[model samples]
Target: MMGKTLVLVTGMVTLLSACTMMDQPKSLAFRHNAVTADPQAAGTAQVTTRPDGMVTTTLVLTGLTPGKTYAAHYHAFGPDSSTDPCASNGPVSVGFPSFTADASGRATTSVSSEMARIAGDLGAYINVHYADDLKVVPVCAPIKMTKG
Candidate 1:
């Protein structure tokens, strides 16, 4: 009976884990842009690479406009500069699902993509923006600090 119970519990745990397929190896901190449109926002983006050559980015945000829609994306290193990926004017490489903050002004979202899509310079940074107004970027999490 004990052995059977152990097997059953292990199976249940595996099933639960399968619901969330991503793994986080390290978390990257987000900083408000010097000329931020929403200075009140804060967050972190955790990037993890799986054995299958897939990447996952999980973002947790705070101090946003409660109940407002927001978008997040991984951006490629741009031509503006070589050292500062965040200020490089990079273009989007992968976009996460749009999400709305709760009443407390907090939100969490994640996106998964094949690693090749955002490898090296292509995954230079991630930024959070107002879904309705892309120009209003509140926070940025630099992945590759320098262009590769």
Candidate 2:
């Protein structure tokens, strides 16, 4: 009767919604913490996965040393998997091209990697290190999946 018809339509709608979700790729974002004396020092990373396993990552940072080059990479740690100091985030999952901050203390770069993804065993962190020494990690942001 009327109630049975309503129930069947709801079930069909739910199934169709799930199918649409499966067809879409995943995306994630990470916000960097201020690790330097400049309280405004911060950064952000946006990660999106393609259907073919390639990952596109974009980084934007501010309040850094002007004209100073900085190295950045993807690390093997999600937001819940690491505990501080940035050293504990594990090894680099993917290395990106170095970028130098502009005179206004801003830098933006986009890179693609076949070994990086928003999910699975590829890890989920975007790490920025000191220009002079890659050993010094000044900004570390763990990627958190925002959409799929």
CA lDDT of every candidate? 0.87, 0.66
RMSD of each: 7.0, 5.4
Model 2: what TM-score?
0.65
Tens digits of lDDT, candidate 1, 1-148 = 9999999999999987864555546799999988646568888887887867787788999989898999988999999989988889888999999999999999999999999888899999998889999888888898888765
Question: Which digits, one per residue and each the tens of the lDDT, describe model 2 over residues 81-122?
Answer: 444424445567787899998999899888887743435334
Poorly placed runs, candidate 1 (over 4 Å)? 1-24
Q: Find the 10 residues in a row with the least total lDDT in model 1.
A: 17-26
What is the lDDT for 8 in model 1?
100
In angstroms, give how far residue 82 of model 2 lies from its true place: 4.7
Error of 1 at 140 (Å): 0.3
Task: Tell me model 2's lDDT, rounded to 2 decimals.
Answer: 0.66
TM-scores of all models?
A: 0.80, 0.65
